[model samples]
Target: MASPARSLNPTPPLKGSFPLDHFGECKAFRIDYLKCLKERDGAQYECRDVAQRYLQCRMDAGLMEKEEMSKLGYTKSNSNRRRVSQDSYKKSKESKGFIAGLSK
Candidate 1:
């Protein structure tokens, strides 16, 4: 019987954790993505935008590296250019409320 061959180049273990909630900046985006997933019955494609925004927030906060973000399907140009405003925050909450109503 032939012996099993070992791979020459093994994938390296991930260096660090992608702490999604370590910073409060991306909390809203994360929640939105999670809610979207639940609403869509775990359909990841439905929440791609929210997920991207959350990842962008992590990248902006230095919680995650650009290379790591790129590996996760985010592009360099996706970096957040402007800060979140109070008006937008209120709008997000209102949208969340609307989504919650749909779940009932």
Candidate 2:
């Protein structure tokens, strides 16, 4: 009798298959994303930030593989940018238009 063949690579599916988070490791993030979607009337694009958070939580919890957010189609969050002070806003308004100085 022939022996059963084994998979040469035992890695799990990269997409559409993930272990259930029975320990609720990412439950809060999932709930938050769901709430955002509900609030947006299911307009998923409006909930991209929350969705990203949920995905990040899953990755951190080992429920999914870690991946670059850029490769996953997410833009760099605004939190990474330097904050502009009220003084800067005023100065920009005084000089160029606020929108024009936004790129500075």
Point to the candidate with the largest lDDT: 2
List the candidate 2 regions with Cα displacement exceeding 4 Å.
1-16, 76-104
Give the runs in model 1 whose Cα sits over 4 Å from its true position.
Answer: 1-15, 68-70, 74-104
Error of 1 at 77 (Å): 16
In lDDT terms, how accurate is model 2? 0.77
lDDT of 2 by residue, 19-72 (tens): 899999999988998999898778566677888998999999889889988778
Candidates in order, TM-scores: namely 0.50, 0.58
Q: How many pairs of residues collide in model 2? A: 0
**lDDT score at residue 36, model 2, on the 0-100 scale:** 91
- Give lDDT tens digits, candidate 1, residues 1-104: 99999879866548576655554887787789999999988856546678888778777887777656567765534433212353466578888775545643
- Number of colliding residue pairs in model 1: 0
Residue 54 of model 1 has an lDDT of 78
